[model samples]
Target: MNSRAIKILRELLASDQPITSDYLAHILDVTSRTVRDDIKALNHSLHMHGAKIKSTRGTGYELLINDDQNFRHYLNQSLNHVSQEQALLDSPDARIRYLVKRFLLAERYLKLDDLCDEMHISKSTIQSDLRSVKKMLEKHDIYLDKKPNYGLKAIGNEVKLRFAMSEYIFDRSETGSKTIWRDQLSTIADADKEQLDKVWSVIINQIKENHISLADIAINNLYIHIAIAYKRIKSGHQVSLINQEFDEITKQKEYRVAHHIVRAAEEIFMVKFPPEEIAYIAIHLLGTKMVSQTNMSEAELENIMEKQIQIMTTKILDALEAKMHLGIRHDKELLIGLGLHLKPAINRYKYGMNVRNPMLQDIKLNYPLAFEAGIIAGIVLEQEMDVSIDENEIGYIALHIGAAIERKKMQSSPMCCYIVCASGLGSAHLIKYKLKAVFGSRIEVMGTTEYYKLKQIPFDKTDFIVSSVPINEDLPVPVIDVNAILSDKDIAKIEAFVEEDIDHVFEYIQEDLLFLNKDLQTQDEVLAFLVDQISKTTKLPDDYLKRIYEREEIAPTAYGNLIAIPHPITAQTNDTFLTICTLKKPIDWADKRVQFVCLLNVEKDSKEDLQHMYEMLGKMVDNPSLIQQLVQCKNYRDFINTLLAQN
Candidate 1:
């Protein structure tokens, strides 16, 4: 079957309910007729495989497997290999990774025509994929050197070349290609799986015996580099480092540990590691070695980490508090954690090492407020220490800040609540005394009042109203209806609300700011559309878009689930607002496909606690089915209702 037909089958298999042809066409960027024809052909193919396309009139298509055994056998024998082969070209993100690995491992320049022939894609398709390939390479300071006859070759510093190679090849989650990197590596050179395993064992033995501390990712990185070094050294390739750098790295304790690791590898591979090669391994060790000085007094923590790192930590927190008043400035745990993290980070920056953060996306989606605070902290860290930090490092810093935020929340004042009663003053006193007895200091009772005087009640200091009688009229604060004596269910409801304090989703979404199913096809187009729509009602800074782009540079705001939450690096408006846009089709935002774009901006010079709003957006970032529902929304009421239902 053709790739499009296979894609239709795949989509149908993934969805439990039937999907309309128009929706499939929109996803595939084809006409409804083409989707129908593909489904027809797909049904034909599935007939012999014990599966058929069950089409529902006025609904859509669903894949029904009549015989699971027969279908599984057919899939294993037929479609499995075809899908793997077709996925490279059928998916742009996958194709870009394929092209990157091809160039990274190529010994000589490659031709465009040859790549097209290999992938069975048109010249235009490969050319379009090349732009993304070039952008990905440029992130690691590598450039594609093009020739008239010879198509393209990646040119960059030798160290960066190997670093990019490790990331693209060894990083299975991000860069797993059609043929595994190990299989390709065996073809490209003398490097084999067995030899790499031996190198890994040697490195682990050395690190354990020498009393050195390194995270698992760090250890894997060192292993990959050393194995690559072995292959290059065997091929008569040597690394070049500045004399000053070579001298400084050789003096560290990590350099001695690297020596043992490299010496063991040299004996097994029957190759010798040059001084520069040993130093390269040492650089990896220096960059990734974690300092464990947690749960100590401030003086003890500061004493363990360098004085310079301690000073940098103080500045980072001070600056973070200055820009965003998160109330974590005096958090000693944060101070100690930042001090410990920044020390190794300094080594990473000095030697230009990039650490991979697997949790970066989850961190951004879950702790958005903390992640934004981490951005401010990153900027402060760069200026305070005169070093550059990437998103991966920023993610690590966010974890510490997130912990501090949690601590602040726990230690902050209790939820102030007001009581309303229709029975009498005695009933209000019984309710208040019961709440205090049950909840203790967790909730503070801000006096009680009768229901008739509720019109004159001020709610500025109250979090919510606990009323024994039902109040039909909407007030500024939420009212929780309860029995006069406050039943256990009522207490549980209040307990849950107090723990989360999540506001309704409607507070963040507005009818005027919501744009559904716009025809924008690119990241820039979507952002510009949202900015234009928002600017109609609210005045925005002249460089508002520029600030958003700057945040994107730090890390793409696309948090998967076809959602991208774009916001400025710093607050841009006088009030907090979110402008949302859902596209007709998914567009490429960095590496992920995004259909729902929420442009977020916090208020400037304001003291609003925005954790609840950020948490709401975070939940949206993590939910795919919810995003689908939001994307399918045709009107503001439906969209708002869908969000409220989910909320």
Candidate 2:
């Protein structure tokens, strides 16, 4: 049976109350039918072992093994015997030999009296065994230290000790009893079986392939494979065999090495690779290493990877179009991965590539596709680039562009801002209002704090600061002093401060042209579309529009003539993006009918971006003729063209 199914059964058995199939399905992230199938498989396996799994209506399956205590006792006895046999074979030295013999004979914890009586040794000799035991325990991360009242005891994480013991036992008997080891290992839950199998298979195969006829390959490979698999699994991938085919004589050796590679990849990525991919990569790497008769340097490996990535990009593009039925320009994803690979090398060079100035001739020769992909990807992902025409610019551009795309996909922001005042109440209120008015609401604000209360604040939380009062203390956040009284100049200054604080905020939005309605319609239609898009993107409820309308009734959206902005005051938005609707016919807004209406759904926390948006709006509002042209726009294309021209 598959390990996944076994895991489900184990979970079911462990639960005190009956678990529903649905609950199992959710835990396994599979359908109820799959869970049922897994249960059936578990039952079949149990039956073969002369055991039965009991199931009842409306409840889950449970193991119904008869004479549970006897079974456990038998298993323990078998383990003890194996341990004794291994101890005899491992060490024949006088000191170790005596300790091993005494340990095997002892039925319970060995007191000094019991140890002396069993071995007919002196107290000092028994004390010497204690010392040896302490030293041995250290190797297993166990401490055999004396306690206040207790004489001496082994103390450590119990699970770690158990794992250590399992490894030790497995290592001791390399070839004699495979079934005994397998039986003992079966005690591990089904969920863990796949992982165990993966580690076991890889190491065994490596040992055979490498022609390493050592008895300890199992233990050595186990340690390396487990470490690597853990890394890969954590990084979001599965572990699998690296290679399937090896000559019978060399299969085991190659498998062992393959496990080590899987572990290495896991460590590097800090994520897991799926079992199948792990297996494939392991096998390929083994074959490559064997054929080449040389280890690949990091640079050489990267070069080979670059070629593979090029192929992957082509495949992904084809898959997107053919299978997904979507037009995906994956140049950005490719460039991002490439840039990540080259990031270390780039850091070595002084004066990073200038993105704004492109050296076409140089780019065409060194990195043609990567260069183009990087520029386009950067534009799409970061919404800006500054390339200069000099010194292998294409590689650098590609790297940054790809990095930008990745950052965009991850939706990460580098800068965080905080507003500070005496009580944190008034300044926070004023700053939030002004900043939201300008930026929209995607930027992050750490939180407002009082000047005196700054000591209580977490420094890591603050990235940039806005405050009314002057403070002498140096802080990590970029401090901007502003007047308590709000004014047009104060607003302008705040806008400028935001731009300085985060250079990318406005530039990214402007470059991406996020506010542009791709297929424009009427002004109202555009507004509705914007609302719909925001709602879909943010997963806002249907009642959000109603809430906004109710809020508007109490206070009009329009601040004044030539400035009509509508928004919901509630902190319901996940992100802040503006929707500027230009009407063919003017709509009545507050005191006067306006040709254009800008809707701002500002998130409460994003002050920097909001400030940037406010600045852009302030510039657009300054032009009355431009506003008139927007109102009289005949079509969507004409409106876009006019807006672009103005910008």
Candidate 3:
């Protein structure tokens, strides 16, 4: 199958339910007919194997496996074919990725001639690719050391080197090229693929036997850690865990599992692992444990959630509510869920163990509001725990927050309806009972009263007024006049009042604010350019740029995927407007490279629902292909067209 077909299959494998062809087509930037043809072709190829694509009439398609053994064989063969196609890495971006893995896993200086021969490229092309590679390496504090006759070597701190290796030596993208990195690793003489497989088998067995659940990406990270450790140990290097950290880790249940796995691997590989090495594996286990959210008594669960964790969770939700107003603070499930997630997460951060969140970009795109709220939670965590939390941890926290927001949406809160009557209490009672019976759980009758008593009643608690008599008093909520015996039209009107559609947020984007193909170098330069441009039209505060800088101090605005949404610490503009700046090239913005800069100035003393704006930007940040299109736009109209097409 082709790359697009493989991507479709990978997406299908990730999902449990049937995915519609239209959605797949939109994601793949292809037509529905093309997606259908690909599905037909893929199924034809899989028929002789185990799996087949089953399509329903109205529903989409799902992959059904008939023979597991045959499917595994087919998958192995396909992966090997993908490995053999490495010689086809001709594009600049493709070559960059290959060279990154190559340099990161290289043992000694690589000669220019050998590199050219390996990639089947010219000297000038290799030189250009090297410039891009140098930029990437510089971000990780790694420098390219070149000598007259010795060629080029990567020089950096060992820890930073391993971090950089972990990033590029793996297929972190949401595609079917997961094991392709392993194939690349086999080409490295120092990396023993067979030894790494032994570690992988040990980890899987321990995870299953101990009933500890881990996502596939987390397991893959564990495998990478083992391979790194093996390589470092063979090269006479070792990672030192603090004595206190080792003590703390040994007290956990994961430590026992790590011990067993380490012993088994040592016996098989005949390599002795120090206690610190075992503790290192235990750290990965502790950070990667998926919360087993199940039914349990409150008393039993309280034992797991310490008092401090509960307080931290409370502070996180409060900050989220104050900043985003997600209206999910009181969700008991959310409170307990965040508390449970933070407990292990706190330990992970205390020991400086960074967990790779494979779905970080996807989570930010799908749940922008929740992800922003997660950022606030990270800030709160930093304050309370005295340890900085990265975006990966924040993404995991967003999952819980997003689930809570969804639960709040699914829960139908009763609309409080108060009855106003001119007649005796009997008529009011009759109307109240009828409304309750009709609306059922949807409407809560807050008690019937006379029209004169309506003034004394608390309208703040009421959503709408059901008045049988003509009440001319202006109130905060909608007043629905209905007969003592409610009519169908009256019910429809009340329904309309109760149900409100979400406001469109992208309407706030002004065409004049868009600036394309600007020559920008640094983060401050981009921010200054945007501020200077918008300051002409809008009345911004004198300390506008300083306010934005302060906000960056609190947390960097770089949200990854070559996108940065920088806003002032507080609202300064007279009106809410989004100013777009697409750079000529990617510039360093703190730790991330950014080319698409969005300066959001919220209206002063204004309360507008801006969740849609965050979601829109999140979509742009998550899709690299979309960002590439956006950054290459030469005009405002082109930018708008590209953005609207995605929607």
Q: List, in order, the clash count of every candidate structure.
A: 0, 62, 0
Better candidate by TM-score, 1 or 2: 1
Overall lDDT per candidate, in order of appearance: 0.81, 0.48, 0.77
Taking the tens digit of each residue's C-alpha lDDT, what string does model 3 give over 406-453? 887679588897899888898889888877777788889887889878
- Candidate 1 minimal-lDDT segment of 10 residues: 170-179
Q: List ranges where model 1 is wrong by over 4 Å.
A: 1-84, 174-189, 192-194, 385-388, 408-508
Candidate 2 wrong stretches, greater than 4 Å = 1-332, 335-410, 501-647
**Which window of 10 residues has the lowest lDDT sum in candidate 3?**
82-91
TM-score per prediction, in order, is 0.80, 0.21, 0.67
- Encode model 2's per-residue lDDT on 1-647: one tens digit a residue: 34365446455544455566654554454678988877887677566454566778755556676766654444334333434434433322334445533332222344666556655667886676666666555544566545454344555543234333433323233223544455444332212444556656655666566754432432442433354335334444342222432232134344456556567545443455554544433333332221221244445545644554444334434432332122234445443344333332221121121111223332322332233334333322221123222223334444444344445435635356677787449657887677666666544666777777877767676566778889789876567777765677766655655445333333323322234323453334545666776665567767766655654443344432233556663445666656565543344443334445676665544433243344455545444445555655665566556665665
Candidate 2 achieves a global lDDT of 0.48
lDDT, candidate 1, at 156: 89
Clashes of 1: 0
2 or 3, which is superior by lDDT? 3
The segments of candidate 3 whose C-alpha lies over 4 angstroms from its true place after superposition are 1-92, 120-143, 157-160, 172-198, 205-216, 241-256, 289-311, 382-388, 418-461, 465-473, 480-496, 502-533, 541-599, 603-647
Residue 521, candidate 3: Cα error in Å is: 14
User: Residue 387 lDDT in model 3?
Assistant: 80
